[model samples]
Target: MAHKKSFEALDRTQQDLRGNSELMGGALVILFGDFRQTLPVIPKSTPADEINGFLKQSFLE
Candidate 1:
């Protein structure tokens, strides 16, 4: 979340830095990422491999 003015990126592997002190501190924060880059442990999850994953097993189907 480098684009965000008040974002704090977790080290993931190591914990050296924390908090949003570079700019003004705020309460609102937004994060977006690709869900496709996840574990392939799901043996029978049809929606996971399909292009319409979110809608494949949804109630709207």
Candidate 2:
């Protein structure tokens, strides 16, 4: 698998998403990390790891 890039460095892009919420949706808000903050307990393996885990266990098995 290819090494994944971090979106942490793209905090500005998330800010743009928030600023454009009307163009996005009242339903969604995007956010980026504060590198000053600690990392997750187990670092994520991929951008979709958390969601994929839930879906695989719950729906697709």
Candidate 3:
């Protein structure tokens, strides 16, 4: 799983590139993963920070 910011950045980039304000610029996005398997790793970060960095904890979720 990736960090929320990573997904957000992708969304922003897609929006900018496609000139669409919608999520992922209304592109066809296919994601395959086991979200429960692992969380995003934040180097030198606290447990709380790591948890909060999860994609599930983001607006995209």
For each candidate in the order shown, give its overall lDDT on alpha carbons.
Answer: 0.32, 0.35, 0.89
Q: lDDT by residue for model 1 over 1-61, one digit each (tens)?
A: 1211112232221223334343223233343564345322334656535433432233322
Reference-based lDDT, residue 55, model 1: 26
lDDT string, candidate 3, 1-61, tens digits: 6789999999999999999999999998898788877888888999899899988888887
Give per-model TM-scores. Answer: 0.17, 0.19, 0.89
Ranking by lDDT: 3, 2, 1
Which candidate tops TM-score?
A: 3
Q: Let me know the TM-score candidate 3 reaches against the reference structure.
A: 0.89
Q: Which segments of candidate 3 are over 4 A away from where they belong?
A: none
Clashes of each: 0, 0, 0
- Per lDDT, the best of the predicted structures is 3
Model 1, residue 60: displacement in angstroms? 31
Clashing residue pairs found in predicted model 2: none
| Candidate 1 lowest-lDDT run of ten | 1-10
- Candidate 3 scores a C-alpha RMSD against the true structure in Å of 1.0
